[model samples]
Target chain A: MLPGFPHAEPLAGLAGGILIGLAAAVMLLGSGRIAGVSGIFARATGVASSSMPRLAAWAFVLGLPLGALLVMALNGPLEPRFLSLPWIAVAGLVVGVGTRLGSGCTSGHGVCGVSRLSPRSLVATLTFMATGIATVAAINALT
Target chain B: MRQRLTSEALVALVAGVLFGAGLALGGMTDPARVRGFLDLFGNWDPTLAFVMGGAVLVMAMAWLIQPRMIRPLFTDVFNLPKARDITPRLVIGAGLFGVGWGLAGLCPGPGIAALVIEPLSAAVFVATMLVGMVLVRLFEKDA
Candidate 1:
């Protein structure tokens, strides 16, 4: 039998989901911006603009690590088996290229785009997801 | 004049929480699990597909409610995009994103959410993502 209540981790995931929804909604209402990660990250890089949106984006980005710090303080540090820096760098470069080509990242298109029901977003999302599924398959085969 | 917080921000916050909770609960925050799923050719973990299915179901519900709701919490009118045709940009972007996700096993939301469990990788991913966004803004002015 599964342990009682399925495990606290799952509950934590539920809470995290609620937080994401709330953050997106709040950012839209308060700042008149979609909490799209690509847009925010774009602005933070000074490529978009240096307005309040950019400032807010910076805050949100910075807050991510801060939040993690808080969590670590409360729950103890995570023991990560760090992947090689070279692999991580390559991954980052690819993601950068993809986001630019896609017009948005998963957060922008996957979460917000799907919520808005844009056919383009839907199609784009499907493509990425299928790719992701395939890539996983391929990687496993190689390794 | 006091600047009232917009409903959008509130929405984003809630959504973010939900997203984070989902990551924590769904075991997506665990890099090892994510890597395992990406190891499709090897271990071929298929759990992520179920998670995506759950998200899609929620999205379907949102679609049903969106039209009837009429007014958005902040805007007088709900803003839907006018374009539906897929462009070259969309296809290329999706492809790139797939490559990155396949290699890294990280997407924006889950990536940011993963900070709670894996700070270093999350930080690097977010930072590099921001840089990519900036570059797009700088070079894609005509776009």
Candidate 2:
């Protein structure tokens, strides 16, 4: 456990993971779609088109915050520190372009794809994990 | 047709809410926590592994069911991605996304969920992300 934020909640993490999996399962079983956030975001924002209806995409998008709100209602406040707005913009811009080009993000590739044992998703997950670790290591060294 | 559409939207909304709540519960909505998890070389937070483990385990089970379903409940056909080959684009794009993720600890799902937590900054990040995605689309069209 790291300092400043001690008590790593593996139980919470596991429970949350189960919820995420259930969400993905619901999506796959109900709508026959991947619960890939970037894909849904793209379709919702008219950046892409697919068999999933635009209305459903928007509904999914709206529900995200509502769910967060529900959790806050039950569990109280969350303490999440964000980067400065400029840094955030840079990061977000890169994420958007990358996810679009790559055809997925963490949820799409990491959770949903890896579970399916899709070789492409496995490759994508491994690539992102390696790069993410390397990037953090570089930042840690510089800082 | 209208009823089916409504059900489809409802399913999507429920799935989205669950996804968002899971991220929040799993301690993923916090960028600092995520960054800590990424910092494998320095003070690591390994609970993220539990989150991934739980999610993947559950989703792996879901995949088993998915293969047996004739059709998803709300849709006529399943629309899962069928891409199989690994390519430069996948590797490059995933690498870029990982960098951005490490930089801000915000991927698309958590980025969107952060709307409730940090509205202004989240708005900026999300806006830039959309712009970047659109730019990629434009570039793709040109290419």
Clashes of each: 66, 0
**lDDT score of residue B83 within candidate 1:** 61
Candidate 2 lDDT at B33 equals 82
Q: How much is the lDDT of residue B51 in candidate 1? A: 54
RMSD, candidate 2, Å: 1.7
Scoring only chain A, what TM-score does candidate 1 earn? Answer: 0.82
- Candidate 1 runs further than 4 Å off: A1-35, A43-46, A49-82, A112-117, A141-143, B5-8, B75-80
Please give the range of 10 consecutive residues that has the lowest summed lDDT in model 1 chain B: B1-10
* Model 1 error, position A69 (Å): 7.3
Interface RMSD of each: 4.3, 1.1
Q: Model 2, range A39-105, lDDT digits (tens) per residue?
A: 9999999999898899999999888887788889999998888888888899899999999988999
Native interface contacts retained, candidate 2: 0.80
Q: Write the per-residue lDDT of candidate 1 for residues A23-118, one digit (tens) a residue.
A: 555544434455566656565666555333444455665544454544556566554443555565566767776786687766667766777677
TM-score of each: 0.73, 0.97
Q: List the lowest-lDDT window of 10 residues for candidate 2 chain B.
A: B117-126
Model 1 TM-score? 0.73
